[model samples]
Target chain A: MGEKIMVKGTEAIGEAAIRAGCKVYFGYPITPQSELTEYMSRRMPQEGRVFLQAESEVATVNMMYGASSVGVRVMTSTSSPGFSLMQEGISYMANARLPAVFVDVVRGGPGLGDIQPSQGDYFQVVKGGGHGDYRLPVYSPSSLQEAVELTIHAFDVADKYRTPVVIFADGMLGQMMEPVEFPDPVDPSTLPSKDDWALTGARGRKARYVTSFDIDPYKLEQMNLVLQETYKKIEAEEKKWEEFMTDDAEIIFVAHGTVGRIVKSTVKMAREKGIKAGLFRPISLYPFPYERLAELAEKVDIVMTVEMSAGQMLEDVKLAVMGRAETPFYGRLAGVIPTPAEILEAMMKEIRR
Target chain B: MSEQVKDAILLASMPKALNGKEFTYCPGCHHGIVHRLVAELIDEFGLREKTLLVAPVGCSVFAYEFFDVDGTVAPHGRALAVATGMKRAKPEMFVLTYQGDGDLAAIGTAETIHAANRGERVTTVFINNAVYGMTGGQMAPTTLLGMKTTTSPYGRDPKREGYPIHMMEIMRALPGVAYAERVKVSRPQDVPKAKMAIKKAFYAQLLDVGFGIVEVLSTCPTNWGMDPVEASRWLEENMVKEFPLGVYVDKVTEVMKEKGVK
Candidate 1:
């Protein structure tokens, strides 16, 4: 709380994860997120931790799954395409109820689109990217300080729920530098022991099994029911968002991550122009603060979403609004970021319409 | 009842490592034998309490049900990679992966190669049955030339279908591998020899040597359209030609000699 220093977004996230008691980091080099991997490779060994440059993203995520299965703090960082490759492993972890953190510094995508920030992976992350009925508690941080705080929070959330948690910052947050203060380092020994479910040699006890395969249809359905119940609990307890000037506002701007910060600036711009505008920033994508958005929709005349995608989050926003308000969307697709002026212009037009 | 009990004398029995569950493999399948050998080694090494097995996705997907030790199942061809994760995370435990040819030689080729290349101190028990057992006898990466199966109805042609992948030979060349062997359990005489090879692979990991694998040449009679006896004979007569038996790597013996372990 007292210290301040300049740190790259990726480095801040990595350091914060370390301070949160992460003992193993397995990752491959990928654009916009390579600095995070490099940071771990340099710092983990100093902390007496494991830092491995895996053969591929496929192997890296699987490695993370293995490490996490043993009840250890393990993680991996990747960009969009690499995260796409990690989908199978992520599903496996979720199904096995293994706890781990995954950092997706999302870049332009659909297919290796470009190396720039994009909230394009919103659906892929918030919605399940892999097979099965699974959800990763997604954290979208708007700044380097938020990235640090969210990363530490990610591990705790993952461990507390015994499910995989994701930090979904895009390229802009990963590559940009900002002043941040990391929390005090955590002692790995003090963390909860995974002996209950981890593969730590079943000495003097019944052997433990970790797998997602359930051949019987009835049994598989029951397994999914169990997972769905967990998701319900998460939705009930973990929905987080920041409301800015929503009171007395006629038009509300819904955004997250870097897009949310931009919309905050645009809200000021629109206010200066004598238009009533406010910002709604969702911190958690999955377990999304949909109820709040719904509440705000009833009060606001227009529910607008601004994104760095064609319009992924708009689907969720509209679903939340459910025709309570007129839903309008503005986005710059394929790695193009929306400026405050462009967003303000869109907000003004929405108000005028 | 006393007289009947007296008449029953046990010569050899199942290893204590088996959980007494019946195998899900088809009749005449060699997975039972291979599983027994692994179980025997687990019993012999006293690794039951300290062993973690990674079961692969083929016919042996239910292997965790048979082994008494703690276990996990990996996606197709990713058992070794998963084992690498388990072993790295818990180095005190002895980790072993049971994978079929399709899982180890085909889709998991990259994982198998890299786990070996990185020299993860783990043991791999590879079952090379030359056919995809669980999915109904499709042509596998190790499926022999001219072999007829569900996918290769016209027989596998080397030019079109490619030759059987000799995995032990391929893995032997990797520096990370401390020991690699291809053994067969086609006949009664071969069972003990195969068991010995599997034991050596386990010892390699216990000694912290390197990655070790024993590619067991197994039979899939249900897929091959042969009875148990015929399948055994067939493996001896034909499958042996494609995947010749013997050690492909032997640093375990070298390490044992250095440490004065007999």
Candidate 2:
């Protein structure tokens, strides 16, 4: 077992990938995510791997594109606008069905909004962040330890589905230091055989071919159908949501990522007041746990969706409820992280309403 | 599972996978010649299994069909980025990006400069034809002065659109480039010399030297509104004058020679 140590969430991600046999790291410097790149730049070279500081956000993403195409485990980390610049590369990765891990340490943003911790990229990440008809499995981790563990698992999920997977966390998780006990690093040799395809030289296997262009609409539609079927399996198997103090609750609050931390404290305060409020925190944003929300909607009186952006995840919550209950939205736009007391007050308003 | 072919690739034999489809190239398009050159090097270096080609927009976006190994298509001007992701994800794979003027020069300028600037282990094959062929002859970033096209119909004046970009000079200027050269497929006679240049560039990357590029000066007869013979002749007289042929930077072999490693 590796010795226990205090590490920043960003550094833990780099260490985990290193143990997972990740051979290459490429990224540009951006606030909120500077540590991930900086950590990798120092560590990867020591591990006898490639670590490059790309010239720009676009170049960094493309460098990621190049490295991933050759069948190596690789990644890039960035804040909002940098992540926005990577949308095009992300879309191509999704379309090409290349397995890769992208870490978005989201900061506040409409455009260069601020470097403060924020979950404003919920919609951009869970939904396709690029201009394409696709979805990358997105994992949101609230804890430092989970950030490390989830990133390793992200690579496996990406390879299993032949899709890009994002370990979605924010500045708070990336920036703050914590005592992290990481699970065993994923062993690459034990993973599934991609010998049937992958460009790392077609040696010893039938020449593997991969491309996104399907001139035939029927073929493209078929590809989408196959992808949808795979995503459905993920939705059923990987949809994760944690419910806290839901028993005999009056108003149930749905939150994700950093918002869940605030909501947890909010639930405790409401329990003290006998306000009977609870929290529903989504771990997998893409799988969404919509069915769980629908099931919970029947027992709860009011449902409130709390977010860093203006109620992006609320749309999915409302869709899940399907008018079974009124899904009220409480959103704090970029920069200001919703506080526990602020969320409790908002839930009280929902209970009064 | 690969079936064994009797002869080794180093014996100057073509791989069984290459379906000899007569190339679909504009007359004198250096892409076809460069494709053959690269294919030959892949055969020579026994890299048919390990090398993957990524073709970009402009005329040869369908390069996936031409190369017998694994290949993928990227969105316009995003080949370098796509290539980056591919190489990063699978480091052992020998990746090469084949890009043209409009694709690499104008839109993908950032990607081009930075990939070299980063000295990515991947080799780049830059086809520097001066006009946009597939988009029906527009003002390519490398279009010569006074060169007429659909967009620059009244001839390209330096004052209006700026002079044609000399990519080799720019690539040479970057400290990160291991090798950079301007080669031409202008005359059928110059084919071997062009092939030599391509092989050296690819070999540099194969040995993990650094970013290497062989800019193959090409022609588009239809876009240039010249006959096939005239296009090649035009490249010899005009294109060669503006973009001089020879190695702009020979750092790759020099490094090896200095160490007596090769």
Task: Provide the lowest-lDDT 10-residue window in model 1 chain A.
Answer: A187-196
Residue range B151-239, candidate 2, lDDT tens digits: 99899999999999988999888887888888887776788888878777886787678888889888888888888898888988999
- How far out, in Å, is residue A161 in model 2? 0.7
Q: What does DockQ come to for candidate 2?
A: 0.55
Question: In model 1, which runs have C-alpha deviations exceeding 4 angstroms?
Answer: B1-11
iRMSD values, candidates in order: 1.0, 2.5
My TM-score estimates for the predictions, one after another, are 0.97, 0.92
RMSD of 1: 2.7
**Reference-based lDDT, each prediction:** 0.89, 0.80
Total clashes in model 1, counting residue pairs 3 or more apart in sequence or in different chains: 0
DockQ values per model: 0.73, 0.55
Question: Residue A337 lDDT in model 1?
Answer: 91
